[model samples]
Structure formats: C-alpha cells, structure tokens
Target: MYQSKYPQNFPENFLWGGATAANQIEGAWNLDGKGLTTAEVVAKAENRKKMSMDAVNEAVLATAIADQTAINYPKRRGIDFYHHYAEDIKLFAEMGFKVFRFSIAWARIFPNGDDQHPNEAGLKFYDQVLDELEKYQIEPLITLSHYEMPLALTKKYNGWADRRTIAAFTNYTKTVFKRYGKRVKYWLTFNEINTGTWGFHATGALDQDSTKNEQLQLRYQALHHQLIASALATKQLHQLCPMSKMGCMLARMQTYPATPNPVDVQAAQVADQKNLFFTDVQARGEYPNFMNRYFAEHGIKITMHPTDQQILAANPVDFVSFSYYMTTVTQANQDGTAVGNMATGGRNPYLQESAWGWQIDPIGLRITLNEMWDRYQKPLFVVENGLGALDKLVNGKIHDIYRINYLRQHIQQMKEAISDGVHLMGYTMWGPIDLISFSTSEMSKRYGFIYVDQDDQGNGSLRRIRKDSFYWYQKVIDSNGENLI
Candidate 1:
C-alpha cells in the first residue's frame, strides 16, 4: 500500500467513478436500428499489426460491411454491455461509485449520419440506462462522440474532412442535449480529440490513399471542423441546458527529455506542444501561435468559415478532461521506439513497463495535473487511466493485485496534485468492467474490477465475475480516498 506525505484528501464532493466508450462496451452493434460504425469495420488485433485508423479506409470498410462474418470483429461483441448494462451498473453501485462516464454511439442515435430524425429505440435504450443510474443516484458524465462515427458519414462526406459533418454532429448533439439535458449535467464533446492529429480514422475517417502531405492537410482540416463543432455544441448546450457543463477531452501524453542535452529538452517541449495544441484551442478558445507556425511551415492550410473563430472564441469549454496512462521520453533527432497510449516516444529507463510495453509512471500523473492546472487554470478531470493486463481466473476468483497496485499509486499522486493547489474536478478510471481493448481488441488484455467471461475469438458464457480489486475499490470509494490498503 502507498501512503501520501500530505494530509489533504480528495475533495468532499470529488466525483470518483469509471468511464467506458459505447463502442468498446456496448455490443448489439446492428440491432435496434443501429447502423454500422467506424469501430465495427476494423478487424481484430490478431489479423492486424496495430490499431491504425489509416487501415480503415473506403475499400476495407466496404469489404467488412459486405461480409461481416468473414472476420471476427471483437468490438461488435463488446462484453455484451448493450444487454448487460443493468447488471454492470448494479455492480458499479455495489462498489460505491459516485459517477459513471459513458458515451452515446452516434450511429445508434442517427443510424445514418445525415438522418432527419433519430431512432427512437436508441434514445429509449439510454433512457433506461439513465433511469437505472437515477435509481442508484449515480451521476452520469456522457461523451457525445467516442470513435464510433457513423460509417455512412465516411462514405458520403468522408467523415469530418468536409464541413457538412459539423451540421450532422451538431444536430446529433442537439438531439441528445434536448433529450437528456434535464437528467445529465456533465458532457464531453469528443474522446481524445488530439488523437485526430495522428489518425484520421479516429476523427475524420478520411481516405487513406492520399500522400503524406495531403493526409496531414486533411487531418488538420477535419480537426478544425471538430473544434468548430465542439464550440457549437458547447454553445447549444448552454442555450438548451444552462446548468450543464461541457468539457473537452484529450489523450494527455506527458513527455520528458531523454538526456540533459538542450536539444533533447527542446525536442521534448515541441512534442508536448503538439499534444497541447488541441486542448489549447478548446480550453482557450483560439488556436495558439505555435500551431500557426506549424501549419505555415508544413504547408497545411486549414479551410475555415468566417464565423468559425468567433464561435470558438465565444464558447470555450467549462472544463478540461483527459486520459493519462503513461509518459514518454524524447530525444533531439531520434525516432521513438517505445510505445504507449496511442503514441510513441523514447523509452524511460527509470520506469517499469506493462505487459503490453506501456511504461508505468505514476508520478507523471502529478506532473500532468500540475502542468494542465498551471496552463489552463480550468477545472481538470482525469477521465481515463488504468492498467490493461492478462488476467487469469482461478476457481471463479481474480486476484488482480497488479491492477490494485497500479491504481493505488496513481490515486495517491492525484491526492498530491490536489494538495498542490490544483482545482481537480474528479477521476473516472478507464474501465471498471472488463470491456474490449481499444488498441488490440483483445478480451485477454483486461482492465476492469469486474471480469466478463469472454475471449479474443468471442467465446464465453458472458458471465460477470467480481475480481479482487472490486472489494478494494469499494472500500476506497466508501472512505472517499481514505482507504487503499
């Protein structure tokens, strides 16, 4: 067990909970008027090298759509959460959860990207979920879009690469805000909006046949549209539900210099800036000067409307949220060979690596919280952070001591960050119940206090088993961050 040097604990009303993406957790992909999503078309990890959105282009999507049974798409059978949410939420309530963060599948609501009306069945499903949460008094933090973009949007408008997607997204947001506004107060515009900087499939769903320069241009253009969409969504939420708060989510990748060399330090700074540019635009409500220089130097011109800047500036997010799994190291002119959290950088020899090669650096969480608080001065939320490992069930019990240790250290650091004067809002760890892995799409690489009986090939009883961490987390929550032992 870890102990904090400071006596200060998490805030009295600090939201302690867990987060899940609809595509990663909710199965029944093609049921109840649900359309296909970008997540549904990507093949499982055994068939692919790594999770690259670039691999999900027009042809690949077409092939996957025509014959869905040819490949065993793991996301299509996501722990059967669509049918098991009540059971899962009951388990969460047993763990003394104060909140739950989940996403609404855009395709589930709209079926097609530009549909005139949302599917009533999809809306009713969430209504049932909210009713359950209300019964348990669990606050909900809902993400509007979470990598499960409607495949039809990619086919017709090439995803967010075209400006028409903005309207589609806004319409979808308006529908949810008007429907769930009275019930849910916290909302996130997108999941890890910065990931779009590297992978177009995650954000834009742009065609992968373009040249490197053309791809970069398309990615930025899509990113611009998303920023505008986020701003518009924020504005609309305020207009519809003045009490609701909107936040921008980022995949926060903290970086350090590989050596004491000045060039290496500068390289690390540049890398950090590239990651922060997305949050800067959302939280600060304007593009930073470094990004302008970057766009000019790289010959990437982002087409924008005359009112886009005004929209963004007038409606900044109420809070800044992000995921913090690991940290990265950087050198001046060397390529990154180490990988973690949808990004690659130099290896940090001081830190230990996870089973999948992600370095574990709990202290980095404190550094990240302090840095973000110093820069934005907005309320911060750590929406995603957890350990994904190979879990073994022995005689109907899961020890999961490693996961317990990982979370204990991270939560201790979060307390340190709070003592350091950061106005932290809450922490919702990545997966409270074992769902599909986003990067590998594997069930074996599990990260949950509650284990679901499933495998990579999609075989199991679909049973839910409480792991050892479940009781430990329950104690922690009951004490409000006072008990970790």
Candidate 2:
C-alpha cells in the first residue's frame, strides 16, 4: 500500500454546492401569470460565427421591447428547470451538494415590475423547488435579482434610471422575504449588480442605442437606485427573516498591469477601484469618494433622495459574495488582444486559455480571495466560478476532461486560499447543469458537470447526462475536497 501526502483539505463545515440563475435555468418564461423579463428580449447569438460577443449584443440590446415572442430570446427557454427541478435537484443530491445557489426571476413574481401583488403561480413554482431541495437537505442561496429585471420597469420607469424603481424593487423584496425567508437563510441582493455600468445588458436595464454621454448618465443614475434598493432589501430581509444573512454579489475580475510601467499600474488600480466601488457601497454601507470624482469627470450627476444615504449606511450586508472566472490586464493603451466575459484583457502569457479565449489562471483565484478578505474582512462566497467551454457528447456521455481539469485546479487554489486565512463561505460552480450561456446567449458554450442535451439552436432531447466531471466533482465533495483528481 502507498501513502499519499497532502495538506488539510476544505474545512469540515465548508459549503459544497452548485449555482444556476432562474433566468438561465428556468424555462416557462411566460408560464402561469409570469410576465416578460428584460432577459427575454435579448436574441440568441449565432454559433456559426466566431465567438464575437459584439454580434450577440447587437441583436440583444438593439431590440428592447417586452414582446419576447417577436425575437429569438434564448433565456426565455432555459433547460426547463421550472418543470425538471425535481430531477435536477435529485442529481445535485447525488453529488452531495450542501447548498444550491439560484436567482429568483423578479418578473415571474411581480409579472410587471410595479405589480400590486405577486403572481401566485410563480410563488408556488418556487415553493415546489424549495420543497424538493429540502427533501435532500440542500440549503438554498437565493439571489433576489440576477439580470432579471421586469421589462415593464425599463419601458415604464426607464429601468433603474428613475428612483421609483427602488420602491417597486423593495415591494418585490418584502414579498419574497415574507414568503421564502423562513426556508432560505442565505440571500444575495443582486447578481453582478455592477454591470449596470460595466456591461449594459448584464443589468438588463440599460439601453444600448443611447449616446455615449447618455449611457454614462443613465448607468450611474440607475446604479444609485440599485444601491438604494439593495440596502433597503437588506433591512427588509432582517425584519422579515431575522435568521437570514444577506450578501452582495459582484462580477469580480482581478486586474493586473499589462507591463511594469507606472502608467499601467495606475490604470489597473483605477480599474480595480471601479470594480470594487459598487460592492463597497453595499458591504461598507457608504459610497466611495472616488465615485464622486468619477461622476464629475464623466459629466454625470446622480440624484438621490435625502434618506438614500441613511438607508445605505444602516443596512450593510452580512457577507460579500462574487464571481471570478478570469483576470484581465489594464494598460495605458486600450489596444490589445482582449479575452474574457464580464471583463476582458490581453492574454496572460503565463497561463492557458479556454476555447472561448478566457485566460485560465487558477492562481488568480487564490490572489483574489486573499485580496477580498483582507480588504473587507468579511466571509466571501464564490457564488459563481466555472469554465465555459465546448463539450462533445460521445457515446451517450460527455467526457469533459477539460472541464474537470479547470475545476480541479480552481479548487486546489481555493484550498490554498482557505489555508491562508481567507474566511471563505462556499463555492457554487456556475451552471452545474449546462444551460443558456449568458456571455454569448448560446447553449454550445457549456459549464456543467451534468450535461443538458440541448444545442445552440435550441434542438435536443432535453435529457440530463452526467459528464465525466460529474463523478470527479462528486468525489471531491464526498471527501470534503480531500479527494482531488
């Protein structure tokens, strides 16, 4: 017999889980009394073309009407999790998930953003899903809103650009907290909320046709409302579910200087600050001062109600959560071979790249964990992290070894970070079961241990096939991250 040597693995009480957004996994977009969400308006990307997200964005934001049927909206039909949740949750339990992170579709609950009450059928659908998760003791980490803002709000109230959206959001928040707060303890106010400015469509609110200056104004103004709404939701959640812990989710892409030049270093620092500024407001309970200078420099002024500051200051989050896939580089010049999803950059010469061009640096995960912990001193939850890749279904099975290797390396870095004194919460690999891709709005780019028999053109048997990574991840969780292949 041979004995192996390794460091102490994941904490005994560490959370092991998978994540899916309701807008990304739950089909039945208009089932029951659900109304159209902003996500339903974006058209699918043509997979035949090179992986150019700009082409997808052109079709996505160019048509902003609430009528999803008129356009080819991929998210409108996401793997049908609404109906197949029982089977999906069963699969998750088989892998021994301690928690499952999913977003709540606001439009499903409110139908219209400003509805007087929630749709009963939409509420009941989640109840059934929650019931299934409870059967397996899988705790739910719910995001109040991902990229799912009701289209009605954007059309009627100019999205979050108008402060009234805060009121509507709080109404929806209060309803959900009352309904599901007892069953769910972990909550995130928004998914990648910073995207209101970073990526227009990520918030599903910003209009793409607007002028550059107009986009800048609307983005910042809209962000103010979301920040207020986030704080208000935190306060309301504690009142409704005193046992609950609320978190703020960000799309965190650690940045590096392209060269050792002082100019590049300064640019990277500014970029990093810009990325953390939103989370700082939510987690620290106040807006950062650099934002004021940023607004002035951009020729934008954000108006806020007198109580907005008080609300934010009073309701800081219990934890901070974020998604990290790849890191980017910022330089004095914007010219570069860019790569990635939320944030792009010149290729990291020391690393590999995913088929989608995302630079793969597992060590960046450890660096990010340490930086976040040191800055905020809060327990961090990696609510989203995974490799989006091209997978082949062979012999009625998908042997996704690349996906396995990606995850294994990331987990090793996570273990390293945990050992380095980062107070980590849990890791929920994004899209455990392949669903519609948010980056390109195509199904071909997958990040799942469980394969959903679907295609970019929305053709397949909707079957769930366990990929090779499924068994690998199962063992990792089964051994509490002690077993790594």
Candidate 3:
C-alpha cells in the first residue's frame, strides 16, 4: 500500500554514485604482478551465441598461461583502469560523486587462488585506487567478488560447487577485511550471490556440465558456498572492522506478471524464488519458506559443513544493496496471452526492451524498492541502476538522448519510492562511465553518462567524452534530486 505522486529530494547524506567491477575496468590484465582468471580466459568469445566447449575446456586446462595471446578474451586488458584510474577518479569527482562502487579482483590478491598471503603488488594496486578515490573525498563501496573469480580455484578445486571454496573465500575475506578495514567502510560480501543458480550458463560462476540437472545442482551448491562465505565475511568484518557497513549485493531485475492469471502469478513467484533466494538468506539469515519448499520438491539439497548453519544464523548483513537494470514479465507457458514486459524469463509482448534485449521498466524500480524493503525491513541501497544503450558520438560530442531518458524516468520512479517511505539510503547508477558488460562482454552495449571512445574490435583512441546525459546527471547530482524530474 505505497503511493506517491510527486518527486521528492533525497537526504543530504544520500550517496550520488556510480558502479564498476574490477575485471571490467582495471585492464592491466596479468600485468603489474596480477594473476590469470576465468574472465581472462572467457573474454575472447564474448557476445557470440556459440562457443566451443573444447575451447573453454582448453582454457580450463591451461595453468596460468603467461602469454596474453593464449588467454581467452583478454578482459584483463580492459580500459586499462590500472593506468587510467587517476583520470577516471578525476572525472567521477567532476560529476560530484559522493561514492564509487567497485570490486576487488580476487585473482589480483591470490594469483593462484590458494595462497595464504596476498600479493603486495595486488594490494598496492587497490591501495592506490582507493587513495585516488579518497583524494576526491568519495567513499568507496567495494564488492569482494563480482562475476570474476580465480581460474586457479576452478581448475584445481572445481570452484564454488566444492565445499572447499567456502573456506578459501572466508580466508580471503579475512585477509581483505584485516588489510583494508581501516580505509574502507562499506563492503558487500558477494556480488549477486543468487545469480549463479540461474546464471551459470551466462556468467559461468559455476563450472559448466552436460546435464541441466547437473548445472542446477552445481549452481545451487555454488550459491550455498557464496551465501556461507557472505555470512562469514559479515561476521568477520563486524568483529574486525567494527565501523564498517557490510551488505550483500543482489542483481535485482524486477518482474511483473503479464496478467492476474494463476500461471503468470506462478511465473512471477518462480522469478522471485530464483532472484531473491540469495537476498533472502543474506537479509533474513535463513532461507524463505517458499524457497525451502521449492528446493525440497525439486530434490535439490545444499550440503553444508558442520558450522555453516550456525555461522550464517549468527551473522547477517547490516543493510541490503542491489543493482537493477530492467524489469521483466513472466508467463506460465509460450502462449501469446501472457504479454507485458520481460527480460530473461518467458517473454511478454507488451513491454519495451533495450538494445541488448533487456526490458525497460522504470516503475519497476519503485516495485523493487518496495518489495525488498517490505520483505527485509532493512535499509536499502540502489547500488546499481542504469540503461545500456548504443551511444554514438557525433561532431566531437556524444548525443545519448536515449540514456538520458532512461535515467530520468528511473530517477523519477526512485523519488516516488523514497516518498512512499522506503528507507532508501542512496542511488548509484551502473557504469557512470563506460565499461565492459557482464552479460554480453562487448563495449557496444554501453551504460554510462560519460562515453569512452572505444569499440568491440579494439579500434578507438580510448579518449573520454561527456555525453548529453553527463550534463543532465551533473544537474541531478548537484540538485540532490530536485532537478531530476
């Protein structure tokens, strides 16, 4: 029962921010004392509909191939954030950013993903990056693990599907919490922990297998490990970094049923179960009733170590954070009757989709805020929300009206959510500057207020230019929400 008709300004402490993942931006791939990862291996076949299992299997078999040409897509060579972060931070400061969210490359720290000590160079790289952000007085919101996990772990230990990953992750978390605890305040235990269950095929968080049932099991197990690691990290951070704000990151794509029909309703429920499962565990410290029932019915049981349940119950996130890009519609079957808006699930004929096939739903942001806050009764942070469109630069200036409109509508809806009494902490759009896409692995699918002059074929000057939305966003941030609508 939430209603708000007019736009409302955010509090003075509201965080006007943007987000990027480590593997997406910090390109110095395998250079400056870094480690090889699955991201590097998988970067080659990005955006293609078909990839050879033999090729993926070969990369998996290769042990830290020193040569860059041997590595897959070379995402480690992304925007070269290692060299350009100073410039990037300056741009973010110009945009009046109060916070900037990014991830810590796990392989950067533990190159082989099994080391007891962190690499000094790896720690120094982030130290310098964080220092740059602090120089601008912008708070850093760091994610411990995004889509990029160490290939060493996957190769030797079979990744998160194995029980040992939880332990390794806990060890890594402790190492990070102890080292960076003083400088960093906000920490996310894991990035979209639940997505692995349904996103393994797309994101490859879980090792691929031949059977769908096996994939589901591996995904479920991987999610279990991530959740446990999250809970453990929360507990450790709270104890070690007493002043830190620890939360879980959920890549939330809000969905609305096409109709009130029972099947569509059921589809929405399925979507919720799929997407919210990790959030439920992180926020509530236990699985939801429906989730438990569904898994039980499916004969999918997550095996846990002796102390995992107690550890998770004892530690829960202090707040909830999520990244929302688009809204979707759900249908029971492939019938045309169920049609509204959809992204990943069954499609709907009635809603608009992005260039990359993601459905655009502005009001769905409001729905997502209400749903998470109402369900968890915790403070919410819109850590990532924005549009991914093909922005073109003309006459030495980028004219991205589509992006401007997308952000404007979403911002308006967010204001409505805040006015409706959702305890929203802040709003940070995904990729305030251009970076690589997690799903497609191409620069063509850009999501930024600022345009980076780069292309899929690696044929651009790597120059940075402000889009039309850049000025628009500057006003939005400066006004603190007054000028958005």
Candidate 4:
C-alpha cells in the first residue's frame, strides 16, 4: 500500500534530464586554457587518504616552474568529455533529454586564482558547447562552482576558510553570469555547498588536526563565505538576467533513526542540523534557532562582517535544489553500544547497500522532498539522484536491471511527494552515461544508463553503448509518472 502517488503524467514543461560536473567528466585537467585545480595535487581517490597541504606546499616551493605544471590525476580526462562532448550531446538527445545539467571548469575560466578577466578561449569553449545543446533543443542548467577550485587559491588563500576567497569566487561567478545569461536559464551558485562539513579532506575547509569545536567553526566560516558569494552572484544575475533561475545545490543524504529511541531521534536531529544549516541560510535567509544553539553549545563563533549580512539579506535564492542518493540510520549509543551514520556506516546490516556501501532507502527520497519543501517553501528541484553499480555487458547488450529497479522505486516515491504538493520542478539523474566515480575516483562504480567502455585502469575503446535501462528511462520520461509504476 503506497501512500504517495506521482502524476498520471508529468507536466508538459516537466524537465526530464541527467547531470555531470566538469572535473568529473571533462578530463582535460590543464589543456586549452585550463589551469591546475586543487584536485591536481590531491591523491587520485576521493574518500581515500588525502595529500597533505603542508606536503603540497613544500613540494611546490622546492620545485621549478615546470614542477608546478598541473598534476595529471587519473580522472583528469575521464571519458575524454572535453573532446567527445559533441557525440555525447547527440547521445543525450537520442535519450530525449529536455534539459541537460553540467558545469564549467573554474580552472578553465580563470587559470590562476585571482585573474580579473576570464580566458577568451575558456569562454569560447562553453559558447560552442552551449550552442550544441541549443541545437538539440536541450535546456542547459549550469553550476557556477563545482567541487573543483583553483589550486593556487587553496595554497595561497587557504580555500574558503579565508574571507578573501569569497570575493574571488564572486568575481569569477559574475564574469561567467554576464557572459552566458542568455542561453543558460538555470544556474546553481555552488555544488554541494555544505560538503565542507564532512568533506573536509577534499574541500580543504576543515583543519584535520583541529578539535571538534574548531571543525565546527571552520565549517561555519566556510558556509558564510559560500552564502555571501551565492547572494552576490544571485544579485548580479537578477540585474543582468531577470528571468534566470538561481538556486543552491547540496548533497543530501536523507537520515532516519534505526530504532524508536530518544537517542536515535537525537541522532537524526543532529544530522539534519549539520546538513541543513547551510541550506537554511540560503533558502530562508536566516539561521534556524536550533542551529544557533548548536553553535553556541559547540563554542564556535563565526565573525561575519556587516556587509556580509547585508549581502545575504539583499540577495536570497529563488529555489532550492539537492542531490539525493541514500538514507542513513542513527542509533543511540546507549551503554556506548554502537552508532553509525551514512558516511561511516560500513556494511550496514539493517539496510541494503550500493556498490560503494551507501545505504538504500527509496522512501527517503519522498521524505527529503517533504523536509525541503516544508523548510524552504521555494520551488525545489532534484538536481541529482541515481544508483551506482557494477553494470555488466553481455551479448552486445548491457542489461542493467539493478539500475532500472532503483530508478523505478525512487521515481515512485518522488511521484508521491509531487502528488502531496511539494512544488517540485524536475528530476535529473546523476550521470546519464557511465563516467568516473566521484567518491572513490574509480571507474568501476558506474552510475549511467548508457554504458561506456572504460575501466579504472583507464583503458577501453572509450565507446558508448546504451544499456537496457536507457529505454526504460526514456519511457519513464515520456509517460511522466504514469509509466513508472
């Protein structure tokens, strides 16, 4: 008995699409005006061990200029998206994508950290890419800043922890917004702005050796800079292009309590507080009372300037968007028995897991939609949602039944949310075609309906083949919600 239901058919303008990021898909790490990003010096894997900032600094200082060349990580040219985007877009068109979500490489635009002007070559690259999408009548949704940041900024300015980095980010966003406002109607200010909380190793916002109190402060300060930059960018977009849709995107892992205990309830509450603290500011333009108390209890304080507060107040976002993948269960540590959340839940027994140990909970998608709608009241978009697995190709055909099942279940829950009046805008699966993995930085954990002939060793024909799920998803998009159930 399902309580939630989707539309018999999606809205006429319902945006059915797929998404990817520049650094994850567009591999040309340093070619054609692209500069070295923070990811260059970092180790190849995403959640594995990290490159020490001190080590990176010493290595850079001791080496000659050539030594400073972009460190070619394994995924820098994943699937060769930089060169094969044209063919890829045609493939996307074949799938009947009404909208396509992707990001521009920040390093490609502003080679160094503090460049006042964007490289013409970099701008022209996107111009051509956008032109291609337009030819296919695919609406482009662009993210201004994804996970990648200029390596120089982190090395010199200490990433988002420094107040000056916010100014530089705003400058970069403004340069692009003014240039591509016409063709690009949907723009996200930041990709997963709250990732700095748990993603300290990759994001470079948190101090690894700092106390828990210090980590909280670093996260708060980093969030402040991102919110200010987002506000500044939104304000500029309003002036330049009034019809554009500007929103904040966050990686949302829906959380649930493992048992009906007070401690488990507390665990879920704390998880929400930690993740939504950034979203609350962006969507509501004010901090939640619980978040204020959370910070006070942790003895963390953010030093915000007067102008920063003004900027946030003047430029609130138009909508909220988030990526939903899995749900984590929190249990009370009674007698210090045990406790685990999604990020740390290794081989969880209470629920099924994905290829990378992520918990599977389809109903969590509906819960996430309701939570966000109740909190923000602005239109919400599911910017990223999909399952990652090891897809096998056989007999000249790839049968990805696991992927189809995952989407069918998730889409059913989404329909229920829409039927209940969540004011949802659209849904864009994470990777429409097989690409590199984000967390492990491995090619094995594939998340696309279209199978690409590549491996973690970076060897394959680089050919693209349509998996069985591709046709299934096409019908889902065509029938909207009617065909999914």
Per-residue lDDT, model 2, residue 195, is 70
Model 2 clash pairs? none
What's the candidate order when arranged by decreasing lDDT? 1, 2, 3, 4
Candidate 1: where is the Cα deviation over 4 Å?
A: 1-7, 47-49
User: TM-scores across all candidates?
Assistant: 0.97, 0.94, 0.91, 0.90
lDDT of 2 at 330: 86
lDDT of 1 by residue, 24-129 (tens): 8999988999998888877776522256445766677778788656136788889888999999999999998999999999999999977999999999999999
Question: lDDT of each model, Cα atoms only?
Answer: 0.89, 0.84, 0.77, 0.76
Question: lDDT tens digits, residues 368-419, model 2?
Answer: 9999999899999998889887888888888888888889999999999987
RMSD of each: 2.9, 3.9, 3.4, 3.8
Which candidate tops lDDT? 1
Highest TM-score against the true fold, candidate? 1
**Residue 472 shift from truth in candidate 3, angstroms:** 1.3
lDDT for model 3, please.
0.77
User: Candidate 4 on 261-330: residue-level lDDT in tens?
Assistant: 8788888778777788778888777666777777788887978887777777778899899998877665
For model 1, which pairs clash? none
On the 0 to 100 scale, the lDDT of residue 421 in model 4 is: 74
CA displacement after TM-score superposition, residue 158 of candidate 1 (Å): 0.2
What is the alpha-carbon lDDT for the whole of candidate 2? 0.84
